[model samples]
Target: MSALSQLDRGVAPIETGMLPRPFVVRSRREELADCVTLELAALDGEPLAFEAGQFTMLYVHGIGEVAISISGDTAKPDSLIQTVRAVGAVSQAICGLAEGARVGVRGPLGNSWPVERAVGKHLMIVAGGLGLAPVRPIIYWALANRDRLKSVDIVYGTRAPDQILFARQLLGLSAADGVRVGITVDLADQDWSGQVGVVTDLIPSMLRDPDETVAMVCGPEIMMRFSGQALVGAGVPAEETFLSMERNMKCGIGWCGHCQLGPHLICRDGPVFAYPAVRDLMSVWEL
Candidate 1:
């Protein structure tokens, strides 16, 4: 392996150029039943370069900071796309904000998915619940560079059929050539005809050369643990599997203690980590 690849084999390098700034909410749209997609423009109307799979700390004037994943690409730096679910006090407050409202933003933080590493390799993305937000950018990146990569597969699971975010967009991508997208719901309705089990159940159906494929996963810890096991069982190497984890992150930077997991800090060392790096901590209750 090359020297840079050798260095990055265990962990991704720390990225630069992301810092806090004030931004304005240019627009907001309801993406799904309870999810809202916010479009943020810089206070001076400039652009911010961000990588796919990275997240930011969104600061509501009086509410507080909440960690959100970047769903847009660096190509369109003038605006940012953040999809949030109204689940907590701060999230509900954010959902209530209107367009033209001003908010504080503190990053394009965290490590991004290894897009370059995934080139020419079969890429498998598994997302569950609101986990789709973190991985959404990679999907767009892959679609834009379809020829450079091999097969692109996405398997997502939601709480219910109505709770599926980016449903139309994903379905359209799945219909296109060289892409496979499967969806599952915990509980199905009469209208639902897709997979009806956990997201792990769909893994076996999408076959690829495990040694030559890279799997990226984001979701609940339990879901990630099970999915990691499934991928290993399907012959994918443990190091080739990456995971985006969610901890109670107070500071998007590493200062706060809320997001720590053992020697690693979810906000700093990861929000995205290789399966082997975090597999041990998955069993620990609080770190």
Candidate 2:
């Protein structure tokens, strides 16, 4: 059983800076080299209510806390889901933890994808590299709420076919009702036979009602920039498109300016925003 299963439910999420809450790893999945998807169950009374695209600050005792996106199925909020890529000390430590390990979790922080707004609109989800982690919940939402949208299309790109996230599931989702998935890779070996090139290369073939399409993109800045341009070129409005921004966030709340970009604090105002809102700022390298 998870350590969280034995702990008591604490307090309401009425404030920030509260000591981290106890949570235990219920399960985990290895998606690629250096990446692990942790399914956590909070040892408490009720699970934190979270929307698609939000993130949490996860604390691995003695190491540190890092802002990781909530990567679980939205319908299963009681189960905390986060995907960690071991690119740093803290993430490496998180990746080393096994099932049933205990950790501190302190959020459902940051803003979320505008799923409600995109409900009646056609949808285009673009993800690159580890970017797919943040976009997973939205895909889940789209799948469950397929009737609310005109269409749902996903374009994913990774270092290689081997680096793709949710490889097994993508195969199933490709055949799911009202959803279309297209994948591309930077390079491939003889054993691989999928599309080769950046994700944007597949955008043209995936275009569907760009004028009415609301795109949500989470990826490297360069990839997002080009994807946005391509979508806009295809008639998707800048204001109707969205992107998730990554910054050096210390505190999960707005009190910390570490995640500031122009007049917006990424923690509070967004990790996700309309393309027009931050299009100019995103042009400024590493802001």
Q: Compute each candidate's TM-score over C-alphas.
A: 0.91, 0.92
True-vs-predicted CA distance for residue 211, candidate 1, Å: 1.7
Candidate 1 ranges with C-alpha deviation above 4 Å? 1-20, 175-177
For 90-133, candidate 2 gives per-residue lDDT tens digits of: 99999888998998888888888989878888989999999998
Q: Write the per-residue lDDT of candidate 1 for residues 141-260, one digit (tens) a residue.
A: 888888988889999988889988887887777546678998999999999888898999999888578888899999988999999999988999899899998887876667657888
- Report the poorest 10 consecutive residues by lDDT, candidate 2: 1-10
Top candidate when judged by TM-score against the true structure: 2
TM-score of 1: 0.91
Identify the leading candidate in terms of lDDT.
2
- Pairs clashing within candidate 2: 4-43
